[model samples]
Each structure stands twice: as structure tokens, then as C-alpha cells.
Target: MSAAAAVLREEIGGQPAVWRALVARGAQVAEVAAALDALDPPLVRIAAHGTSDHAGIYATYLLRALRGWTVVRDSMSMPLYYGSPAARPGELAVGISQSGETPDVVAWLERAGREGATTLAITNGEGSSLARIADHVLAIGAGAERSIAATKTYTGTLAAIALLAGQLAGRGPQLADALVATADAADALLDGLDAAVAPVAAALARIDRMYLVARGIELATANEVALKLTEVCYLGAKAMSATAMAHGPVAALDADVPLWAIAAPDATLPAVAEAVRRARAAGAPVIASGPAAAALDGAAFALPVPVVPAEPLLSPLLSVLPGQAFAWALAGAKGIDAGAPRHLRKVTSAA
Candidate 1:
């Protein structure tokens, strides 16, 4: 393998260890959760960008479903450009950044802190600016990520969000165990990537664009995976919730444009399956991934992921692995450096 692909693979291979470390350091999350519980915020406002924004989306669904907190994905523009506070006094404001140095995110959290909201920073950077600015911090423990594509940090952020949400919801122990199990599942998936993801990557290497569809919490997976493909493989990958796809985007599907469907065995499976049916009927190749992917009829590729048992919300922790691996493998197949994409930097600074 080229050095570029090797760098990306090494980081991806380290996710299991990152998650295990996060679980081992449960006290950090507990402290943040305790602070949150004491504040008893009426709502949550999350500030993030790019991949971190996708993690925020995952946290939005998890926090609302698990703890009944109304969560909002705050567009930093509201505060940075318009001088409006993203959070009210006594509300919870979260800033998510892999580097913990995103200018807009830092500015938003600063505004929240000034507004008397409790600020929390979820990031891999423990002593970074975002961590220092927040009232509390939960480090993802991804450990010195070198690849610009952000494989481990993304998963690490999701794991951190799960731990925090689980703690607030009073299911910390159970969720921690499930997360450790997810780490093991991720290890096994990495061990078998050649068998599972190589063929799919080879088949998709020639395609210029694709669609990723999912619903509920897994919609975050679709969006993140689409971003990965766009960044690494340089594809025009669009992501949409299944309901949104059915509305009008279904018309754009055809044989040349493939569709990747993430259908975990949860409340959204029926609608996701229906979306798969529509994609197939449109003659688009359907690549399915999730715990219940095998059950999707007529899919061109079915990548069945490990089920997290009773914790369906934790499925994204496992479901997103194949998409990550596919991006790396497809980049290799297309002779592109997965670690170094054009016109991008590790830390993006936008106002």
C-alpha cells in the first residue's frame, strides 16, 4: 500500500483503542453529566462544523431520544454574523471540534458563555481552546490524529457523545459496556475489511457520484459517510434522510448513480427499506449496510454490521465503519491518496 493509504488505515485501525480509552475514562463524562444534571438545562444548542457537525447531529438525536432534552444544531452564522446568542441563560451549549480550535465554534461557545449558558466542549483536544473556554470538557481520547480525513476522531466524538448522553439518561454502565462491545465489533470488522468492503469499493471506483440514504439517528451516518466519500474519493455524494429522498430526490436516481442505504434494525427500517425499493426500481445499484442490511431485498451489496442488541441508537458506532473503509479502499482503487486530498487542510478556519 502507498504511504498515504497506510496513514489513513493506521488511524482507522486505531478507533477501537480510542473508544476503549474513552470508556475507561468514564469519570470525565460523568463529571460533565453531573454538571449538566445540576444545571438541568431546558434545551441543548450544539455548535460544530464539517464532520464535527455530523457528530452534533448524532448527539441531537441521542440526547433527545435518551434524555428528552430538546437539542438544536446551532448554525454559527446566527451568532458570528448576526450577533445573536445561540443559547439562552441556563441552557446547555456544546461545542464539538476534532481539533478544538475551530474559530466559529470557539466564538459561538464564547458567546454562549457570555450569555450565562453552561458550555461544554467535546473534542479530541483536551487542552485546546474550545476545552479551555467551556465550563466542562469531555475529551474523545483519539490520540494524536495525523490523517486529515479524521477517521478515529469522528468515531471518538460519537463515542463521547454516547457516553455523555448515556450518563445523563442514567444508563451509563450499560452504555459503556455496549460501547466496549462496539470496539470489539469494530476490531472484527477491520479484520475482515478485505472480504467485506474490497469488492464494493472496486465496483464503485468508476462511479462519479452516489447517494446515501438513512433515517432517524443513522441519518447522521449517511451524511458523514457522504462527506468521507466526497473528501477522500472525490465523489459527488449526497446524503438525505429516507423521507426526504422520497419527496423529490428519488427522481434523480438511475443506473449510473449508485445508492448506499443504511438501514439498521430499528424504527426506521421499514421506511429505509422502502427507499431501497425505490432506488432499485429506479435502476440504481443499492449498497446496503447496517445490522439488518441482509434483509434488504435485491440489494447489489449487503454489508451486515454487528447488532448492538437493545441499544439500537449505538448502531451508528458500528454502522459507519464500512462506509469509512469503503472510502479508503475506493480511493486506493482509483489511485488517489486517501490521506491527502486536494484543496483541503486538517484545520479549516472560517469566520
Candidate 2:
């Protein structure tokens, strides 16, 4: 690999090790679950910055669906930029940061902590600032990431959040086994990266802009991958729900802009299929993923992901892997620096 792409190769390929590391720390994961078990779901809020926020939202979607509790993603602008008083009386506030030190994330959790909330930090840096301020911490064990575009840390956070959400939903006993299985599946995907690169990159090789569509919880994956394509590969990618894309963006579909759809195994599959139908009708290429893959065979390219038993909660973690691979390979093909993009940093702080 060229020096420009080496970090991308190393960090993305290292995800299996990260997964195993997080699993080996099962006792620590259990501690995070125990802390969530003590709190009332209605009193819970999660604060995070950038891609970390996507991880929290993915977990929040699962927690809300499984347990029927409203968990909000606290908008950091209230405390950091607007200078408004922090919302009070939250029983728990979870902050997520790969470095555990994004200024806004730390400050929001600190204010929430002062207002009688128990703060928990989910991060890779066990001893970073957020960890010090938090009442609890769940380290991602992804080790040191060198790529400007996050690969391992994002997935590590995904697995960690799934654990906490599963525990909170009273599915605690099954979480570890589920996580292990998830990790195994992820390993298979990464291990086959050499085989995957050719097809995935070919699917994405020509596009300058495209819509990555998902519904329900999988939106988190779509949004994160869109950011990755832009930040790392200089692709003008957009992420939106299939329903939204079907209503408006579908009209813009043509051969020049394809539709990349994520159809998780849920009630939302019909909506996703509808979007795919619309795109194909408009002469746009379609590439789909998720369970019930046969339903999407009419697409120009299809990567049928098996419905893992750990799904719904673990779907985004599974679904996002293809996007990461595609973006990295496409970047390399385009001669862009997939590891280090211009004007981007591994740790962003100002906002």
C-alpha cells in the first residue's frame, strides 16, 4: 500500500483485534451494564460529538425499541455554544468520544453531572479527560488509531453501545454471546477484505455523489458512512432515510447518481424496497444490503447480509462494515489519501 493509504489499511484491518479485546474485557462491559441497570431509562440522556454521537444514537434506537423508554441525544450546542443552562434532573448522561476528550462532549457531561446526573463515558482512552469527569467509563480497547477517518474506533463504540443497551433492556445474559458472535462475523468480513475490495470498489468506483438510504436504527450507519466517504474519499455522499429519499430525493435519481440502500430485517423493509424500486424506475443503479436479501435482487449490485441473531441492536455494526470497505477501496482507486484527508484531524474538538 502507498504511504497515504497505509494507515487506512492498518486501522480498518485491526478491527477484529479490537473486537476480541473488547470481548475479553467482559467484566468491565458488565460493569457498564450494571450501571445502566441502576438508572431509570426515562432519566437517561447521551451526549457525544461527531461520529461518537452516531454510536450513541444507534444504541438509543435499540434501547428505546426494546425497553420502551425515551432516551434523548443531548444537543451539545445548548451548553457549549449557546451558553444555556444544562438540562437538569437527568439520572444518567452517557458521553462517547474515541479519545475521551472532545471538549464539547466533556463539558456537556460535566454540566449534566453537576445537575444530579450520573455521567458515564464510553471511549478508547481509559484515562482521558472524559473518563476523569464521568461517574463511569467503558473503554473501547481499539488501541491507538492513526487514520483521519475512523474505522476501528467507530465499530468498537458500536459494540460497546450495543452491550449497554442490551443490558438496559433486560437482555443482559444474551449480550456477551451476541457480541462475541457479532465480532466473529466482523472478523469474517475483515478477513475477506481482499476478496471484498474488488467488488465493493467497483460498485462505488464511478460515483461522485450518491444517496445512502436506511430506515429506523440503521440510519446511524448510513450517516456515518456518508461522512466517511466525504472526509476520506472526497465523495459528496448524502445519507437519508429510505422513506425520505423515496418522497423527494428519488426524483433526482438518474444514472449519474445511484442509490445505495440498507434494508435491515424489520418492518421498514417495505419502505426500503419502495425506495429501491423508485431508483431503478428512474434509471439509477441500485446496490442493497441487509437481511431477506433475495427481495433486492433486482438491484444493479447486491450484497446480501445475513440476518444475524444479534441483529436489530447489532445491525448497524454489521451493516457499516461494507461501507467502510467500499470507501477505503474507492479512495485508493481514486488516488486520494484514504488515511489522511486534507483539513481533517483524527480528533476534532472545536464543536
Candidate 3:
């Protein structure tokens, strides 16, 4: 195997170990929780780009669903380039960066701090640029994500966000326990990948474009998974919420355009099931994952995840594992290197 391909395979299977490592750093997680609780902000605003932005989206679902906080996933361009308005006093602004040196993210967090909002940084880098400015920082703790296409760091962000949300829900211990189980579930998912995911990967290898629809918190997973498809496999992929697909996006479905859906066992499952049923009826082959894997009945493919069901917010960590494997497998099927895709870098900073 090529070195790049080997690295991608190793990292894809290495996610479980990364999650366990983050849980081992209980003290650091507690410090982050203390800072968030102390702020007690009425609204949470976040700035990030790419995969980090998807991590913030998962956190947004948790804060809104579990704590009833108004969460905004900011585009960062407004404050960084457009001179947007300042944040209000009762607001908490968060900046997420794997490298912690993205100029736009740093600029946005600095701007929010100056506007009187408490700032927090979630990153993998220790004492990096974003960490220096923020009042509090939570390390993603994935440890040395060397590949251009991220696997462990993305799951690390999900786990870290789950830890924070669990603290807010007054179940820190329980959530930590759940995260340990999640890591085990991730291993089980990885163990079955070579056999269970090969056909699914073969099916997707020839496809040139696809759509991924995920409902509720799983929308976060859909976005990240879609990004992987494009980043490594060069599949023209678009991601949207289940509701958006039902409302109007469904018209685009056809036999030539497949839809990959995350049908997790959440309250949104009923809605997602209906959407998938309708899309399949409209001739769009659908691939589904999670406990509601049945939602993809008669789909071209279904990759079941071995997940220990937790709160809806925490399910993304498990569901995303299969997506990562599928991307790597698809890359292998197409004879391309997964670790280093064309025109991509491990740390991309436009500013």
C-alpha cells in the first residue's frame, strides 16, 4: 500500500484509542465545564470553518436540546471581514480550530472578547494562538492528527462537546461512562469494516455525486461525512437536514443521485424514516446507518453502526465512524491515496 493510504487506514482505525485518551484527561474536561457553567451565558455563538465548524454544529444541538441555549454557528466572515456588530453581554462566543492558528477564527474570537462576551476556545493545539486569547480552552485531545483528512480529531471534538453538555445536564460521571462505551462501540464498528463495508464502498466507488441527509443532531454527522466523501474520494457531495430535504430538496433525487442518510434512533427518526421512504420511492437509492438502519430498507446499501445509545447529542461520535471507514475504503477502491488528496493540506489557513 502507498504510505498515504496506509496512514489513512491506520488513523481511521485509531479513533477509539483517541476517545479513550480524551476521557483519561478528566481534570482538563472539568476545567472546561467549570468555565462554561461560570459564564452562564444566555446565548452561545461560535466561529469556525470546515470540519471544526461541523463540530461546533454538534455542540449547538447539544446546548440547544439539553440546556435550551440559543446557539449560533457563525460564518466568521462577518466579524473577520465585514466588520459585523459586537456580541451582547449575556453571550458566550466560542472559536474552534484543530490547529488553533486559523487567522479568521483567531480574529473572530478576539473581536467577541472585545465586545464584552466571554470567550472559549476548543482546539487540539496546546497554548496555540486561539488558546492564548480565550478565557478558557478545551483541548480536543486527539493527539497528532497527521493526515490531511481528519478522523480522530473530529471524533475528539464530538466527545469533548458531549463532556461539556453532560456537565450542563448534571451527569458528568454518567456521560464520561457513556463516552467510554462509545469508544468500545467505535472499535466494534471498526472491526466489522473490512467485511461489512466493502460492498457499500464498492457501490459508492463508481458514483460521481451524492447527497447526505441527517436529521436533528445527526445533521452534524452528515455534514462531516459529506466533507470526507469530497475530501478523499472526490465525490461531489452535498449535505442537508432531513427537514430541508423533505421541504424542497427531495425533488433533486433520482436513480443517478444516491442519498446517504443517518437514521439514528432519535425522536427525529420518524421524520427521517418518512423522508428516506419517500426518496427511495422517488428512485433515489438510500444508504442508512445507526439503530434505525431499517429506515434504509430496500436501499442500495446499509451500514449498521454498533452504538451504545446515549442522548441524541452523543450519537454522532459513533455514526461518524462508519462514514470515515467508508471514505477510506472508497479511496482504496478508486486507487487514490486517502491521506493526501489533491490540492489539500493538513492545516488550511486562507487568512
Candidate 4:
């Protein structure tokens, strides 16, 4: 098996363990909500790179929903690079680093904090440079993630972001309850994932490229799936705004290419469903991964749980697990050692 796949077996061991983490994540959200009240910044900024971009995006959406504070979320535009150059000096800089030592995140936050902005580092490492540099620190209780693909850390980050979002919007009670609800769903979906394994595995051996399509909050889930596929399975995967797919990438599909549609319980589902039909008519193998029950010409791997509500912008968390499981299965099938990748280290100190 690929190292990445091995890590899944080692980490999850079974569906119950994974489900337990999801359950605790709900409680963690309440804790996170309580923590965010301490940082009443007029402006909030999420500064992150690589896979942590998912966290930044989630935080941005959640904050906007819970507290009307203006949020600026940044992510690397290219590999091994910092985020967008649109960093403002007035906002609270929230830096996210799994190892807590990404040089770009560290450098940006350090500079921002030095410029008089309150900085917060959300990380698993309590002793990393960011933890030491930021004015405040929110530690993710995901424990050690030996696998490089970042399963638990990603979920933990989302939980932390949800809490921050709730606090900023003065929706602490609502956000806490939402987290608990989402976690319950996450656990049920993880425990009953067997229903998806067969179809996911069937698609893995038959396709060359994977296209994850979604709109609105579902776009974040699409991005996370694409990242997991590329990072662990070492495959070619792309995420597109469902409408954007109609313009260009749609021309590149065929039966050899498999598409995964992110169908959420929202208005965007109709358009995303149409996109799946377009790909299928062009002879592409498509899989639906969301709350939707059926697909026109493809298989639908519906989650065992229901979708969560979070103002339209926060729908990403509900579908994140299904995509994660799909990627994890593909990685295992290929025997790729997902804990590490080519020419990459856990920490980049060169910057």
C-alpha cells in the first residue's frame, strides 16, 4: 500500500476512531467560540499557505457570518509561496501552520505583529515560531499527524475557525450548537463510509484525472478534495467554480477522466448537477459526493448524515469528510506514502 494509505489504516484504524474525533470537534467549537471573544479586533485576517488555506477560507466565511467584522483571507497563489500581496496593516493577522513553522506564515505574521496588529497563531505545535511570535495562540488538539496529508489537523482547524467566526458575529451559542451538529454528522458519515468505498475504489482504477466541481461554500470542499488527491495520491486533480467549468475546463473531459461533483443542500446544487450532466454527456465518469441522492449518468456517494446550516457561506464543513475519505481511499489504493511528498519537508526554514 502507498504510505499515505498506510497512514489512513494506522490513524483511523477503524471508522469509530475517526468518528470520535468528529464528535469531540463539536465540543471544541464551543471552546473555540469562548476563546474568540478575547480578540475583539475590528478587522480579522487569515494568513495561511499550502493545505492550511482551507482553514483560512473557512475562518473567513464563519467570521463574516457570526460577527460582521471585515475579513481578509490569503493563500499561496503558487507553490512554496506566500499568499496574495493584499495584506493590510490594520487587521488582526491569524496565521495557520500545521507545524507552526512555515516560514512564509511566520515572516508575514511577525512583520504584521511588529506593525502593531494583534496576531494569533492557530497551530498544533505550541512551541513553534508562530506560537512564540503571535500575541495570542489557539492550539488545535489534533495531536500528532505523522502522515503529511493532514486529516485531523484540517478538521481541528475548521473547528477553531468556526469558533472564531461565532465569537466575531456574537453568535457564540449558535456557533457552538452548529459545531456540535456538524460533528454529529461527521461521526455518522465516517462510521458508515462503507457505502462509499466501493464506488470510490471503482472510480480510482479507471480514471486519469479527477475534477471536483462545486459552487459557493461547496467550492471550499472541492478545493480540499483536490488538495488531498494531489498531495497523497499524486494525481492530477483540479477544483473549479461550477459555473467556470462551463467556459473552459469542460472541453477537456472524456470517459477516461472521472469527475466528482460536490452537491450540497443549496441553490447551487442545480447548477452543479447540470455541470455533472455536461461532463457525463461528454462521456466522463462522474461521482456525486454530497447530500444529493441521485446523479443523471453517474454514481452518487451520499453521506450518512444530513447537511449543516451556517448562513450560505459556511456549507463547506458538512461535505469536507466525504471528499477526505475519497482521497484517502485513492491514496491507499496506489500505495503512495502520503505522509511525505517529493522534495518537500515538514518545515521550510529557507525563507
Candidate 5:
């Protein structure tokens, strides 16, 4: 393997360990949860960019599904350009960044604290600026992700969110156990993943662009996968919920543009299967992943993943693995270094 591929693979392989370590640090997570509960925030606003933004999206779905909190993805531009809206007392403002030095995110969290909202930072950068500014910090503890494209840190962020949600919902012990299961499942999945994804990567390399579809919680997985393809493989990938695809984007499907569907065994599986059928009718080849992938009628390829039945919310942590593998494989096929995509930096300063 090339040096670039090796670096990316190491980061990808390290995800399970990072997740287990995050769960092991349960005391800090519980303390953060208690602080959040004390605020009893009626609403949550999250500020992040790129992959971190996708993690924020997952957190929106998670916080709602688990704690039934009103959550919104806060646009940092609002604070960086236009004046930030006055934060209501006891509102929760969260800033997610793999590296905590993102200027806009740091600024947003600092402003949030000044505006009387409780601020939190979920980041891998324990000593970075954003960590210092937030009222509470939930460190991802992924430890020095070397690849420009985030692998472990992204999943680490999801794990952190899961931990926080579990604590807030008073299911910390159960969720922790589920996360350990997820890590074990991830280890098994990673063992055979590259060989399984090689052929799919070859097919993907022939396509210039792709569309990814999912629903409910996996909607974030679709979006994150699209970002990975875009960053690592230089594809013009778009992601949307299955319902949204049917409403309009489905018309764009054709033989030339393939569709990747996250057909996980969840409440949204039926809708996603329907979308797969629609894509097939439109002559778009479909690649489906998740435990229910094989059951999705009309999928050209199925990548079945292990599922945590006890905690359905933890599905994203498992489902996104195949997507990450595919991106790395596609990058290798195209002779691009997955670790170092052009015009990208490890830490982006969006301010």
C-alpha cells in the first residue's frame, strides 16, 4: 500500500479503539450530561463545518430521537457575518470540530456563553481554543488523526454524541454496553471490508457522480458518505433523504449516475427500499448497505453490516463504515491519495 493509503487505513482502523476509549471515559460524559440536565434547555443549536457539521446533523436526529429536544444546526455565518441572535437563557449551544481551533466555531461558542446560553464543545482537541471557551467539553479522544479526511474523529464525534444522549436520557449504562458491542462489530466488519469494497470501488470509479439516499437517523450517514466521496474521490456526490429524493431529485437518476442507499433495518427501511425501486426504474444502479441491504429489492450490490438491536440510534456508527471503506478504495482506484485531498486542510478556519 502507498503511504497515503496506509495513513488513511490506520485512521479508519483506529475508530473502534477510539469509540471504546470514549465510552471508557464515562464519568466525564455523565458530568456533562448532568450539567446539560441542570440547564434543562428547551432548545439546542449546533455550530460546525464540513464533517463536523454532518456529526452535528446526526446529533440533531439523536438528541430528538433520544431526548426529544428541539435541535437546530446553527450556521456559523450568522455569528461571523450577521450578528448572532440573542440566545435564550438555558438554551444549549454546541460547537463540534475535530480540531477545536476552528475560528468561527470558537467564536460562536464564546458568543453563546456571553449571550447567556450554556455552551458545550464536542471535539478531539482537548486543549484547543473551542474547548477552553465552552462551559462544558466532551472530548472525542480520537488522538491525532493524521489524514486530512477525518475517519476516526467523525465516528468519535458520533460516539460522543451517543454517550451524551444516553446520559441525558438516563440510559448511560445500557448505551455504554451497546457501544462496546458496536466496537466489536466494527472490528469484524473492518476485517473483510476492503476486499468486499474493491469491486464496488471499481464500478464507482467509472461514474463521474453519485447520489446517496437514506432516511431518519441514517440521513446523516448519507450526507457524511457524500462528503467523503466528494473529498477523497473527487466525485460530485449529493445526498438526501429518500422522501426528498422521491419528491424531486429522483428525476435526475440515470444509468450514468449510480445511487448508494443506506437500507438499514430501521423504521425508515421501507421508504428507502421504495426509493431503491424507483432508482432501479430510472436505470440507476444501486449499491445498498446495512443489515437489511440484501432485502432491498433491486439493489445491484448489497453490503450487509452488523446492527445493534438494543440501541437503534447507534446504527449510524456501524452503517457509515462501508461508506468510508468505499471512498478509500475509490481513491486508490483513481490513484489519488485518500489521506491528502487537494485544496483541503486538516483544520479549516471558516472565519
Candidate 6:
């Protein structure tokens, strides 16, 4: 094993013991809808655990776009110390906790319920405090998320949210097929990870910073990867919109910087491609991960995967893998402990 891999192995075995249950639970999108059905009207205001808020934000955006419902995306800040007091009454506050028992999340929802908001907990823990107090519960089934950085659980939440949105939109059958197919695609993508990891990590190691750029849903995945880079590898990486990168972030680019462009099969791919070109002109090394595997000039690494049809809303889930693998491999290369980040506790009690 590489030094980074040894660190990972020592910190977190190859698989989190939680994954078995999470995978099985991720298979329970049907149950998630049933729980949603039980609590109708006023919609869900989603809050996800800290460091994992991007998934919840993307999921909330997808829900609002698909169902025309009001969706509030709350951040889980200092899980035991900070809480949102602006939540309105009668709304279903959905808390997404991979650990189920994060003190702030559990306490917030418990308080939300007491204040007349129906609490629905989406978590891996069936017996967790949030689950117990929730008026309704939609378990994430992401199993045990052992790595201090979440991977499978984030994907599982995307899948669950997609299913929930489809059900609310009355497109259950189509969504069900899409969910199964997405899991298969994720599996296929995971199979190719070994080949993709080395070059991406090597390219990353050569540079001091990376700009993860993409459009629409993929932008959120970019942010997630950026977060992982900062948290796990302590790297200077930023995730930004393709358009925003041009307006300002692009100005900071230089030859040694690496830009990781996330390309989607959607209509926005052209804009994403052009952004990569602009970044390269600034002398930054570029890498693109997408369906076409279109070898742009200086594009040192490409992940080979088919462009399967996906809901525009769910595209982030597919695009997330390459970045996730990139961050994990980068963590290993730098000898950072993936299971535990420096000066960080799993849950926060300090404000």
C-alpha cells in the first residue's frame, strides 16, 4: 500500500461496516416515499449534517424544482452548539444525519417538533434520537459511514431525494427504474476507480490547488469535492460555477494550478468545455471527467464511463464519484488520515 493508502487502512478499513446497512437501506427509496406520503402539505425543509450539506442543498433544489414546493435548505453548523430559530410552524423539518445522533441535529429536530413543526429524520440510525422524535422517519440506509468524510451516504441521500421528488411528481415507475439503473452505473463507475485513481492523484499532487468547475447539479458535486479536499487533504481547492469562474475565480489561475472540470452529457457541456479551455490558457494543467472522455488538449486524466440518460436534477450524483475518488486518493497520497481530520470532532459542542 502507498503511504496514503496505509494511512487510510490504518484509519478506516477498505469499507465502512456501516456501508452494508446503508446500501441495503439505500435500496429502500420506496419506504422513503411512503413516509413522505404520510406527511402531506407544507413540504419539507431539509437540514443535513455539517460537511455534508451540499447533498442536502442539491436534494432540496431538486425537490423544489420538480414538485413546485417550498424547500428550505438548512446548514448543520456546530451540531451541538448552533441552531436555526427561523423555522416556521407546521412545516416538516427534514434532518439528514448519517450518524443519526449528532447532538445539534437531534436537539434541533426535537425542538422543532415541540414548536409544532413535524420532524422527519432521514438517517442511517433507526434508533437515533432524531429518528425517535421524528413524526415520520425516512432512513438513508447508507449503512455505517466510517470515514470521517462521507461517500456512500452522500450518494444514497441523492438517490433517496430523487426518488422522493419523483414520487411527489407522480412519476414513481420511471424514477424507480432510474434509481436501480443509477446504482448499477455507480457500481460500474466504482469498478473503474483503481485505474482512474493513480493518474488523478499524481496530477493533483503536482499542483498546489485545483478548481472543480461544472454546471447545474454537477456544480454542487464540485463543491462537495472541494470540501473534501480542504477537510481531508488540507489542500487549497475551490469549487465554483463555470460562469462564476470566468467572472472572477479564473483570474487567480497560473501554470502550475490544476483545474478539474466536471463535464456532463447535458446541453451545458459546451460551456464547461470552454471553461476548461480558458483555465488551460492561464497555464493551468487540466483534467476532465465526463461521459465523452473527450481528450481535451492537456487533459491528463479521463474516467471512462458511458453516458447513461439521467434526470437533470440527479446528474450530480453520477458526476460526484470522480471527485470523491480524486479527494480520497489525494488524501492517501498526502498521508492524511481520512478517518479523522485534525482539530475536528465528529460533532461540535463548541460554538
**Per-prediction RMSD in angstroms?**
1.3, 2.1, 1.6, 4.0, 1.3, 4.0
- lDDT (tens digit, per residue) of candidate 2 on 286-307: 8786554468657877665556
Q: In candidate 5, which residue pairs get closer than 3 Å at backbone N, Cα or C atoms, i.e. clash?
A: none
Runs of candidate 6 with Cα error greater than 4 angstroms are 2-43, 75-85, 292-298, 310-312, 337-341, 344-351
The candidate with the higher TM-score, 2 or 4, is 2
Q: Note the Cα lDDT for every prediction shown.
A: 0.89, 0.79, 0.83, 0.68, 0.89, 0.68
Better of 2 and 6 by TM-score: 2
Off by over 4 Å in 5: 84-86
TM-score of every model?
A: 0.97, 0.93, 0.95, 0.83, 0.97, 0.82
Residue 249 shift from truth in candidate 4, angstroms:
0.9
Candidate 5, residue 298: lDDT: 73
lDDT of 4 by residue, 58-151 (tens): 6766666567677777543422254344344556778899889888788778777766777789887889898899877777766777766676
Q: 255-314 in candidate 6: lDDT tens per residue?
A: 777788887776777778888889888987777776644744557667644565845465
Model 3 steric clash total? 0
| Shift in Å, residue 24, candidate 3 | 1.3
Q: Which ten residues in a row have the lowest lDDT in candidate 3?
A: 305-314
Q: Considering TM-score, where higher is better, how would the candidates rank from best to worst?
A: 1, 5, 3, 2, 4, 6
Model 3 misplaced regions, further than 4 Å = 310-312
The sequence of per-residue lDDT tens digits that candidate 5 reaches over residues 1-351 is 678778998888889999999888999999999989888899999998888998998999889888989999977787678875735678999999889988888888888889889999999999999999889999999988888889899999999999999999999999999999999999999999999999988876778799999888888889999999999999999999888888888888999899999977767888998999999999999999976788788788888898788787898898999999999999989888888899987776555
Collision count for each candidate, in order = 0, 0, 0, 11, 0, 8
Model 1 / residue 43 / CA error / Å: 1.0
